[model samples]
Target: MSGKTVIARFEQGKETFEILVNSDLAYEYITGKRKDPMSVLDAEEIFKDARKGERQGEEKIKKAFGTTDMATVVDHILKKGDVPITTEQKNRLMEEKRKQIIDIIARNSIDPRTNAPTPALRVENAMNEARVSIDPFKGPNEQVEAVVKKISLILPIKFAKIKINVNIPPEYSNRCYGILKQYGLKSEEWLSNGSLSAVVEFPAGMQTEFYEKINNATQGRAETKILE
Candidate 1:
């Protein structure tokens, strides 16, 4: 397996220099021994470490110059595509990820309404209403477009396209539209009651699943007149 050599450049006060290495040379630089070319990820890391060593050597050259060119120094560094990761850097990333997961698990454990229980349960219930708002520029097909776009991110479908009809006061029509849009539905003006009726489509077929999610999210106030 052959790959191109890497040249990493850096600058000192007035002089610019580079380190040139083939895959074999990078392996030796990283592991202190030569080995065959390996995965791109491994090779990249090795090259980054070698570049660090190269930078140290270049620093000595800078002392000879009375003034430093920042732009030239930056350009030299950019020529190297990979960034080195130190052990401390890796550890810090891992710790951040661990904290994020712990937070999510804690959040999902609670009961939102009663607040009587763990955050995990509340989060689980909340996920049902977690929706991607439909973009209006797509036109009336906004709801349809949303389902197609975001279905992959949701849990496996319980059913296909459960329909819901919504009616809201003419004054609050926009607010209702916003709410429906939250559930990935598109709202259009309806002649009846001058109140708008929006059709919300969901992948879940059962009325129970659809209504339960809608009621929970809208606080049982979002009226839905299911039309078959």
Candidate 2:
């Protein structure tokens, strides 16, 4: 034990578990920087009360987790459990996740006014201006929309993409399906007449080229409509 430890707790219906583990290591392990959950442990033991060092029993462990194997139990505890962290650590992780959200928006979005890619710095400034709060523990993809919505109130921003509903004749559907997948096939369905009805999206800048390629591939037989 390094003695620099914190209690990571997990609780649910009939399951109350805790472990005393190094705080920094548990944080890294939960965020995927550290793979070996066992390595994060200060002691290879599960506790009903970590502060008191009360060891939980095997039958209860097996009942709660479906197995009492120490490695498996530890993995579940470290992952599903809450590892209390310092405010400084929480702030640092929040900052990193904020940068990820900004990068994603800047890469795939644009200023609707001129259809120009919004600079990352501009996005960051708007985020600060909007006072967007980011969740460090939540994945960036999950938070992008909410952050974008908040930032959009302060900046003229929108994702730079065009969605097209395309209908392909049976002979060409199979061939064009692969092409649509390459673009960004959102939703697809087969018609009663053996045709393919699908929606595909691509970067706005590729609008002209996308139509040309699809038209040529389907030999002018594919029908398409621009979605709002």
Candidate 3:
């Protein structure tokens, strides 16, 4: 008696084949080891057949592998034999998503016309406005300065870095700086050339007011760089 094991199969109404292998066999066989004379296909042969011809077509093979589509189903069972991404990877992916959300919030603020500021920008503008409103006086210069100060102040503290640019005349510049300074902004680095160019720091938020302000302030002399 041979100490060989047989792998038998019956396909409902179809013909059955028996595969056999020695119990002590250490190497895999490309061709199936058959104890019965009816075996006609090896493991490679079956797989090749599964990939081609009407024997194992697209729909039939997918059904066998229990997948909805031929793309992943075929690859999953034939190549990897399992889904890859683990729970840990999923958690890390979620963390990355959360970080992205935080970034968006920190960088952008709402539109005054729209009332929807990004998280970081919102914090800066709101805080700056709150600080400015406490001054017991307000004007065009103070209003503009208040908002700019809000943007400038929040950016450095929350995001740690970013630059803002303001272009106001010598007459208005002094008042602008005064308002910003009054809001606890501490830097002359924000003041630019003699042509009313003041650079402040903040995150990348939509500068709706900045755009409209430039056209109004210098009568279109100042141009804002908008990133699409």
Return the top candidate by lDDT.
2
lDDT of 2 by residue, 115-157 (tens): 7667789999999999999976677889999998898878887
Candidate 2 stretches with Cα past 4 Å from truth are: 1-3, 55-80, 160-228
lDDT of 2 at 87: 87
What's each prediction's TM-score? 0.30, 0.59, 0.23
Q: Give the top-scoring candidate (TM-score).
A: 2
Error of 2 at 95 (Å): 1.4
In candidate 2, the residue pairs with backbone N, CA or C atoms under 3 Å apart (3 or more residues apart, or in different chains) clash, namely none
> Where does the lowest 10-residue lDDT sum fall in candidate 3?
23-32
Instruction: Give each model's clash number.
Output: 12, 0, 12
lDDT, candidate 1, equals 0.42
Model 2: worst 10 consecutive residues (lDDT sum): 202-211
Q: Which is the winner by TM-score between candidate 1 and candidate 2?
A: 2
lDDT (10s digit) by residue, model 3, range 1-228: 323432222121232212222322201111123332222223321131332321334444434555544334322332222112335533543444334433454445444443333554355355545553322111122343344455554443222233444556554555455443432332444334554454554433534434454456455565333222
Which candidate model has the greater lDDT, 1 or 3?
1
Off by over 4 Å in 3: 1-162, 178-195, 223-228
